[model samples]
Target: MDSLRADAYLQHIGVPRPGTAGAAELRALHLGHQLVVPFENLSIHLGQDVPLREEALVEKIVDAGRGGFCYELNGAFGGLLAALGYEVTLMAARVFGEGGRLGPPYDHLALRVAAADGSGPWLADVGFGRHSHFPLLFDSRGEQSDPAGVFRLVETPEGDLDVLRDDAPQYRLERRPRQLADFEATCWWQRTSPKSHFRQSLVCSRLTEDGRVTLSGRTLVVTGSDGRQERELPEHEVLDAYRDHFSIVLDREPQVAPLDA
Candidate 1:
């Protein structure tokens, strides 16, 4: 990523270029990204191939004004952070599923960022839907409280870190750093495998000032301090909801592809 692209990414996320990349700046960028770029998996259903390369991810997210799942979101965000002088390392994680079973090797992608001001080594993840609003201290073992939830990083006997939210395990982080290409196979599996959850549903979600608004399939769900409200949208209104809520304009609404397709 170049200076021009970095500036464009910052503008796309509605954030200002920080004079120094530090903890505060990291928080702002993390939150700004969460608020602006949605966590979505529409490509798989839209019959679109999700390329894991940096240039393709940037074009889709920044230039095309679209959002993507973990690999694309963190991959692009990591690039922008590195371009802005942050020491960014792409890390692989295995998500914890039902009964605490760990998923595949590269089930998720996150960033271990060392800010320029020496305030970091923070776990910066903008792709996980409904996760911590800001970066979490990487080395902190105690519970870190955020508006999203109370999070804790527990070091396992194997030296891997288990990320927990509100006392529930989210995913396990490996110590080894990874390259964007390393996730290509699993990224392919995520989008193509019939068993993948992403292939089973369509989701587009973003954080709002007070809460969150999500479009899961055709059901629009809004949750805030007051409470939660959900309503199913007709086919005619689905495209408008995507535009109004996520700034994503699609000619046709993405539908779940046939299992054999």
Candidate 2:
């Protein structure tokens, strides 16, 4: 990526350039990106191709002003961090799926960022929806608190670490380092398979200062510091909500598929 494109990414996330990539800088970047970009799989619902390449990911998220699921979001984020001279490794994780079952391998993409001061690695994930509001210390066993929830990482008997949010198991993370290409098959499955939630639901959501705003299918759900609100939107109103809330302007109404068991 060129310096110009890098500047565009910083602008997209509303972040000023950090002279050096440190833990504090990484934390700020993580929060800023999450606040600006959304966690959505609308492209999958719209039957659009979801590419896993860093350049394509950047084009969609930063250039095109769109959001994507884990692959696109984390892939792009990892690339940006790498460009900024941070020691970032793409790590694979298995998400806790329907019925509390663990999904297949490479179900998610996260980052292991080494501290600029050489303290240790920290888990920085901007792609997980409703997860920790900031990065969590990788080696710490104690509970870490964030605006999203209280999180704890515990080592399991199987040797993988389990990430728990508010005492609920979110996912078991493998320590093994992985490349972005390792997740390609799972990304394809998620976009195309009927069993995948990304293929079923149409949701576009982003974190707000107070709480969150989401458009699920035709329903607009908003939860703020004040309270929660939910209402069904008419077809025309749906597009308006996407534009107004998510800053996404769609050419046509997105096709939503039914969720499969």
Candidate 3:
């Protein structure tokens, strides 16, 4: 990677420059940006191939002013951290949704970044559709509070990890580091299958310094340091919420046909 251009990627994902910023600040920047940017598949539904190249991904995200599913978001952000002089590794993860089944291969891509001291690399995932805004400390058997909510990482019988939030389990992650191409087929299946949740809901979210906000289907949930609230809204409100919170334009909007769901 061209080091100068790579430095630009650091700014693209909002990882702060070490010349002034610290770890906590960098973590906050990344977490908040991911939430604000969203993790949507509108482009895919509209016939855009989520590209793998770092330049293309950055162009789409920062220039076009859009958000994307795991690959585009995390993959591009991974490039950013690497350029920022962080020891960043691309890790693969599997989703554990309501039914409690492990999602297929390449369901998610997260980052493992080591601190300057190398105490242990942290699990920082900004791509998960719904997740904590700050980096989840990798060395935890305990829960921690972030701008999003309370979260914890628990090891499975297989030694992999599962992310739990609000006492509800989310995705299970493998220990293996992954490549971007590993996720292409999985993304295709998700967008095309009736079984995928992304095919069922119109979601847009963002994490902020105080809390996180999300519009899921017809429901809008806003959580802050004080408390959180969830309420149902009309379709127009949902669309407006997407544009307002995440800056995503759902031109076809999932509400009309309900996303093949």
Best by TM-score: 1
- For model 2 the local lDDT of residue 255 reads 68
lDDT of 3 by residue, 7-85 (tens): 6555665655565334665576576467457777666446667667778887787777788778888888777667666
Clashing residue pairs, backbone N/CA/C < 3 A, model 1: none
Instruction: Give the top-scoring candidate (lDDT).
Output: 1
The TM-scores, one per candidate, come to 0.98, 0.96, 0.81
Q: What are the Cα lDDT values of the candidates?
A: 0.94, 0.87, 0.73
lDDT of 2 by residue, 1-261 (tens): 667778899999999988888888888899999889999988887778987888899999887889998888888988888888888888888999778899989999988888676755889898988888788999999999989889999999988889999989998899999998899999999888888877777888898888999888898999997799999998878788888998888888786766652
Residues 1-261 of candidate 1: C-alpha lDDT, one tens digit per residue: 999999999999999999988889999999999999999999999889998899899999988899999999999999999998899999999999999999889999999999988986899999988899999999999999999999999999999999999999999999898999999999999998887889888999999989999999999999998899999999999999999999999999899988898
Which candidate, 1 or 3, has the higher TM-score?
1
lDDT of model number 1: 0.94
Note the clash tally of each candidate. Answer: 0, 0, 1
Candidate 1: residue 124 Cα off by (Å):
0.3
User: Where is model 1 more than 4 Å wrong at Cα?
Assistant: none
Comparing 2 with 3 on lDDT, the higher-scoring candidate is: 2
